[model samples]
Target: MTSRRSFLKTSAVLGTGLLMAPNLYARNKKYIGVQLYTVRDAMAKDPVGTLAKVAKVGFNTVEGATYTGTQKFYGMDPEQFKQVLDDNGLKMPSGHYMLGDGMPNAKGTIANEWQKAVDDAAAVGMKYMVCAYLLDGERGSLDHYKETAHKLDLAGDICKKAGIQLCYHNHDFEFKQENGKFPYEILLNSTDKDLVKMEMDIYWIYKAKQDPIALFNQNPGRFPLWHVKDMDKTPKQMFTEVGNGVIPFKDIFKHAKKAGLEYFFNEQDICPGDPFNSITQSYSYIKKNLV
Candidate 1:
């Protein structure tokens, strides 16, 4: 059987000689966006097909989650991936990158060939590049976060030159206090406001026992991106589709203006059934209620 990657390569080689309609997805004004990582398995198997399904489920925008390892977007080079997005009428305004300390061998990360990464991001029309997460080895003391913040500012400078904003996406660990100081606060304070911004993960913040509204009020306009997910009400607090959990999304969304949110992506790290079904449900709820 022809592998999906092989098929895509062949398809790319045989150009259709077609042009995408100008501003096709932009004209549609699709408000709902999803993180491509939500369907990681499917993306690994067939990114093109998965993206088509994502569009069919009513998501007009997507945030990419992989680039460093292969220096490609879902096995396709930047140009090819951009064409795939255009073919599906989807826009990718943001993508997740890494600091590279954890993956010392990884390329195209903030610590490696970051300029090339920024350039590729620009080619794909991305406005923001996010520091996805800090691996366990990368996080230790408050000083580590301070160092990470400095790195973010440095990377941000490069991204700024390419018309991209650099952001930090937090997990629950950032909220944990190290020597009585919250690493999250250290990050917010240590980085340049214009260069380094926040991409608040709603589920993680809530899980950490912090209030999103309070964070927005405290640092108004410092956040430009958000990872939207929900936590079930069970004791374990497993992941659930948006509006099917106790995250109080309506209340959190009310402060989007204060948060300076430009784009938000639905990202459920785990799901109960088909990831597509979970995202579809989230998209429907967000479209009907949250926007």
Candidate 2:
């Protein structure tokens, strides 16, 4: 398999624009964003500088990944973070927030911190607050997933009241079967469609051997956000920059309308070098090919 860097070099030689013609325009002109988690280290060091680099790479929007514990976004207050984004010509329409340790009591009331998270998200002008992951203790049986779904609905209600939407971001584990049923299915069926939407990580969906288009067909308009990463062609299937791997993104982008895609972000969890380079390569490919 070609290394992502090498593939990018080769594509440049092939004349990227000429090779990737007939591109589909993005439904939302600012749909191309980068999930900041892709550069967590840099963000931790200097969020302002990192965001400037992100803007320089041609990203107009960003999805934040660091809003846990700090009660602030990337070590700054909500207003400060918003100003940083504005200075860099960027907007954050969505952000990842962990459903904290406490579960809803028997009365189905969530913790105060969760409500605070919703409030903070709204203050930052974010339209979506994504339940980014589920801990090991949070998963096991179908009933556990159903319970989580109930919590998601409660959280979604809070977010809806705050004028923000709540979404769930899935990993491959959600697709694993427990007692002949996928937890993903439980979450989808158990949650109220209007309250809880989904953010599809296309790479993980492929890793789980599932078809994104099939899911879109089954649950039309449920996925409004997507994490666009590619899997290396090798059996190990390591994460690679978009368009440098075997995943057929062009085919996937063709179904954006059916999937109700409002925003898509490039997110490579692990990169070979500077994360910005990985994002830039993905951005170039998306602009010239997938849109």
Candidate 3:
């Protein structure tokens, strides 16, 4: 059997070439997005198809990963890639950027690099450019996070000109306590809410044993994006299909209006078998139960 990745490649290009009108999904209440990383393997093989399948699954929005070295959308140049989304009736309102990295000629300066990312995101009509991850030492200390907060403020300014916002996505590390408080708290308190925003990954917050609703309560309207993934039942905290894990996703979403959730994406860092199946199951669960 051909891998679903391969199938999507062949099917996507052909389907798109046929100039089929994009399918409509439950836009308002659902508002589900896909973290492109969840389909990275598929996208690497066939960018167009992977995206088409994502659209087919009823996702209205996407948060992107870099498509190969192009540092652009889905391995195609800007126009071609935008056409793909248009042809598929999809929208990418946000993107995961290599924040504080990827600058040219600075000999290890991250500011210029993040500037380029903001420029690209703006060109693509993305409202948000999100700092996706942090390496081992790159996370830095609370003070370093303070510095990052400042950089984020600058990035947010650049995006502001283009009518975009910059946000930070978190893993478990931000929850690490320091001086009787969470670094996440430090980041929240230090940053300008109007400028530097958050894309809270719900799974990671749960994994770190924090309350998503409480986070929302403490910092109301700071979170504009959410990675609505769930955690497995076991101690390992593996990413499971949404609503299939111990995380009380429904309860969390009950506060969505107050949480200021503008976009939500489904992401699983690793899939148990076929990643697409995991996605479909997650989509179905969200559509039927949560959305």
**Best-matching candidate per lDDT:** 1
Score every model by TM-score.
Answer: 0.89, 0.87, 0.85
- For residues 44-162, write the lDDT of model 3, one tens digit per residue: 89988888899998887888878323556776666677788899988899887655343333311235555555566666778888877766666667787787778778777777877
Question: Which candidate gets the maximum TM-score versus the true structure?
Answer: 1
lDDT of 3: 0.74
Ranking by lDDT: 1, 2, 3
In order, the Cα lDDT scores of the candidates are 0.84, 0.81, 0.74
> Candidate 1 lDDT, tens digit per residue, 1-291?
433233223323111211122121121224579999999999999999999999999888999988988899999989999999999999999999988998889998999999999999999999999999889999988888888889999999999999999999999987676565677777877888779888999999889887788776656666778899999989999889999999999988887776677788999999989998899899889998986
Per-structure clash totals for the candidates: 0, 0, 1
Off by over 4 Å in 2: 1-26, 102-112
Residue 41 of model 1 has an lDDT of 97
Residue-wise C-alpha lDDT for candidate 2, range 1-291, written one tens digit per residue: 333233223322222222233232225855689999999999999889989999999999999987765677898888899999899889999998776644433111234477777777887899998988887877878897888889899989988999988899999998776665678877877888779889999999999887888776556667889999999999999999999998999999888876668898899999999888899999999999987
Q: Determine the backbone clash count of candidate 1.
A: 0
Query: Residue 158 in candidate 1 has what lDDT?
Result: 95
lDDT of 3 at 180: 49
